[model samples]
Target: MAADELKLENQVCFALYAASRAVTSLYRPALDALGLTYPQYLVMLVLWERGPVLVKELGQALDLDSGTLSPLLKRLEAAGLVRRQRCAEDERAVRVYPTDEGGALRDRAMSVPRKLSGATGMGLAELEALRENLVRLTEEITAQQD
Candidate 1:
């Protein structure tokens, strides 16, 4: 109690962690309706944005390591949402792309962000500014780590 920095309530990490969980929980119902987990939703987001991306590029975009990404991709493939194939030029490299069903899911996913944004009770501009700040913070910290 003597040092504010030592208090859990005063920790930025705790705030970020709590906020992340809360926001994720808000997405649960919507994502469940779409038959996607949060992580799966993230992968789909990347796939939806950039079709036919290298597995390594996907891993980097999602900031997930192979150990974590491999299983997730396998599950998605099993679900028939995505497919993995070896690159034609480089047999050692793998590429991931959404299936027809996966691409169709994009239409349903259009409402997800709007729903989450509404839940936040923040205006579009305010939400954008907040997102920009968060991205800057992440980039700065990640740069320091590297």
Candidate 2:
């Protein structure tokens, strides 16, 4: 076969995109149980790791925009998992804090990582390697975007 860098099958970006969608599909049912989508689950992970963060910070962490995040936050709020309030010092900025229900949901969410590990049937070392590779690729992509 002739070399063609522009070919879709030769593209790393397409591979990454396909893999990401597959991985998110795996999480769909797991997240649905918690009444959250994959993106919402990511938001929960960020907030759980760092409590009471500003909306902008959450958006940055998730690499999403306010336009996309605002509606998701509203859904999370309606589910009683999170609360959004205007920051005291900066009224223009909104802060997102987890509710007691949200905090409790973390306990339920904790099982997900382990369950997914089992479902994937990949050992810890292999999983770590995959994570490291993905992180490196993500950093490279972000650097290119800059």
Candidate 3:
């Protein structure tokens, strides 16, 4: 019974992990045309919504650490989609700002949500409910860690 409980098929984390990967894969082809990866798209989304943000704030917002974010930001900078510079007020802090080209990408990315929704074949309300539930679950798990 204990072994049965330990099976991969029975783990919610495994289910979530697999589902996350599968959902990300759906974005690959679409993101490919935009010259972006899933992580990069996520960064762009944050920048698009928040304007210039400190690197630490960006990491906190995205639930990422500098080790993971640094390389990704470097790549985006190289692509001319974003710029990273030391904050004048606090030289120790770095701020990331999206370029004009990055802002322009938003128009091209408008169809991504529609494409993903079509692929899921789920209605907006249903998806919203699911997202809310997942957000609650994530909050609960993170709360336990604190």
Q: TM-score for every candidate vs. truth?
A: 0.91, 0.89, 0.91
Q: Candidate 3 lDDT, tens digit per residue, 1-146?
A: 87877785568788899889999999999999999999999999999899999989988998999999999999999999999999899989999999999999999998887777788877889989989999999999899998
Please give the range of 10 consecutive residues that has the lowest summed lDDT in model 1. 1-10
The clash numbers for all candidates, in the given order, read 0, 0, 0
Alpha carbon deviation, residue 125, candidate 3 (Å): 2.2
Residue range 1-146, candidate 2, lDDT tens digits: 45575585568778888888988999888888888999999999998999999989998888899999999999999999999999889999999999999999999999887668777777889989989998997899799987
Name model 3 segments beyond 4 Å from true: 1-9
How far in Å is the alpha carbon of 129 misplaced in model 3?
1.7
User: Which candidate has the top score in lDDT?
Assistant: 3
Which should have the higher lDDT, number 2 or number 3? 3
> Against the correct fold, how does model 2 do in TM-score?
0.89
How much lDDT does candidate 3 score?
0.92
